[model samples]
Target: MRSIKFNIIVLLTILSLTTFAQTKVVSNSYSFGIILKIEKFAGRDFRYSLELKSTDTDSLKNIVIKVQQVINDDEWLDVNLAKDVTKDTVWHSLKISSKINPRAKEIWLYANFEGNGNFFVDNLKFEIKTESGDWEKFPIKNADFENNENNPLKDFRTNANIPDGSTIGLRNRTDSIGGKALLIKTTKASVIFKTNYGANKRIGKYCNINGIKIYYETYGTGEPLLLLHGNGQSIVDFNKQIPELARYYRVIAVDTRAQGKSIDNDSSKLSYDIFASDMKALLDSLNLKKVNVLGWSDGGNTGLIMAIKYPDYVGKLVVMGANLNPTENAVEKSMLNQLKKDLKKLQQKQDTESKQMTRLLLMLSTEPNINVEDLHTISAKTLVLAGEKDVIKAEHTRLIASNISGSQLIIFKKQTHMVPNENPLLFNETVLNFLKQEDVKN
Candidate 1:
């Protein structure tokens, strides 16, 4: 009986050694790949036990195993034995260990031949040896099968309790919050243009004003000119004319509220007033007493509001493709309705918040006040620009120029609403000529 007991102990020791072997090889090409599906777990360490057999010892050293989480397809983890492993016999066992994050739902394992060798595997096993405890719990409690619905949390004092209200509209907010690094000032640098010198530089550190953080870039040196962009575009939209405009004047371009790298706010409360206020805050933050303003599309309307409500902050104004009345175009009304419908679908889908914000901007952009008479009260030196093909007829642009005392009108012959982007050279030439005239008068 003692002899039999000793033999059993020896067999157990051999089994333990066989179980810990690290290399696995397959025999037939058809049976080469192995699929491992890990069970769903909030937090756990996944352990896999693999059995390997190689008909040719030369094949063991060339074995490779690929491991990856199933949900995100782009990333992969590779596991390899420390040394070459060749199997002369059948059913050699190996153990592999990996830790899965709390959020992981499933994982996969595949075995492949690194070279021409072949082998097979059986008696595969997987288990969770440990669990992660510090990981944050899912927001919803009792969210199990059949009842797995959740709602976003909101602060009533700031944002509305609506799930959509809590979302900030932006993608790549972390990376693009200040525009791409490529577009910003890296260090103190200056470029010399034909007539003037331009310096591409950042003006100030990021600051939160009225619950929004604003960033601005400045170019050239002369009378301050504040350039505002339309919806869905950042300050980068001025890249084409930055160098040229900077050559003549101190050109400052800004990423408006909830767009580009600017901080997002409650979408439900966002209106043109909020954007105008944000621009005012930026100017105040910069300590600029007054500036010449140039705005395109939504930016143009924003400039008009600034000139109307805070006339002291603006010296001269140039507005392009600006609508003085919101109800002038039926097409715009139809577009807004379509946008509202699309927004509802987006809310239902709970898609990216930035996409929703983009839709909202589109709706607000076309709702400009159409009454050109409003410009008559603006005291700043004014330039009304319209693309020959602008949705606002050339006659309407002339009407705007006529209303504002001493305001000049320029029409780009073949241009449309997108003059700055599509006809940078012509737009810059026209703007420079007007600014030069203003300089001569001053």
Candidate 2:
């Protein structure tokens, strides 16, 4: 019976010690600014720490310091009130034991003055003790929650308006390839070559064929070179290489369907055939019988399709990060999540039609029909460029190069899916070299 009683007491003592160890407090004494208000805060949990340093009883009676919690704009909670004790210098420590609401966005410690008499407060601090879980900071700033005249969200959302075909303004500004702007104004003595072409309003003068508008911005005077952007990007994705490539060839950068200023129609019905047909239409519209093609990612896939389906229109094909197989499960899941988030936001803003279009585009982007067997049919002089870390595995790239008759393969060291964008200098140099080599061979 005695052992049982002793065990119960020991358990109680352990519980008490555990509770005490969870909270800590410290105090400091320093003077600054107004006497009626506390100037400097030094230690933690000062809200619970009370100090009285006075021998004269009359002077102490008029002093009062209250600690309050600012809950919101109009609400406050008074949690501490210090009492005077007889001493020239006195230090008091208090431990705070309270439950805090997990959902409360912000908590502020405020010192409230009661009487007009000068009251000095020094070394004030408050630390919240929580047993719940680790706190995660939200990305939204304090200014985002404010709806007044100085609110930043009003201007933020206004500037975030990314139209279908025009450039998508980067949120975090950088001079990187993905963020560079495309120069679109016409120059003097520009050659006008017009043909029967349906213009897509979104991507400014790019031709639409078989319900897909291929984005193409042209410059310089030479053999035509069709440029294709990678996934999740538009013509703007090739901004860095445009000026240089344009100097040598009549470079035409295209934003494939569902990416950058291009229309997102029935994405579910999308395939390389649709993209190839669109390119054929674009070529037919421009009255160009044949052209060199440079494609990145999905554009590479489209280029392969064009070479296979309409070999007459392709002069030389340079394909980068092109995948013969469908995207893997992990890649598909990540892509779907991003698409879902975008769709949700669009739906919330009453963009019902755009939501469906985006969904269709995602479905098309992940279609599993295209494979290595289909690539064997390509007859164009192909130069397969694969980034070292490209989403398309090395074996697949090798297979693509092997299957395509007399195709050359070049692997860019230490590169990824955005190799063209990430390493523009190397990408351009390699392509120019390959084209020159093909020229010699032909």
Candidate 2 TM-score over all chains jointly? 0.50
Any residue pairs clashing in model 2, and if so which? 46-125, 164-261, 165-261, 215-254, 267-360, 267-361
Say which candidate scores most in TM-score: 1
Question: For each candidate, what is the lDDT?
Answer: 0.55, 0.52
At residue 241, give the lDDT of candidate 1.
75
Top candidate on lDDT is 1
TM-score against native, each model = 0.51, 0.50
Give one digit per residue, the lDDT tens place, for model 1 in 223-262: 8888888766667667677778888888878877777666
User: Every model's Cα RMSD, please?
Assistant: 22.6, 23.6
Which TM-score value belongs to model 1?
Answer: 0.51
Q: After superposition, how far is residue 52 of candidate 2 from its true place, in Å?
A: 41
lDDT of 2 by residue, 340-398 (tens): 56545554644645555555455445553565676777777889988776667777788
Which sections of candidate 2 miss by over 4 Å? Answer: 1-204, 208-215, 263-268, 327-357, 438-442
Error of 2 at 295 (Å): 0.8
Model 1 Cα RMSD, Å?
A: 22.6
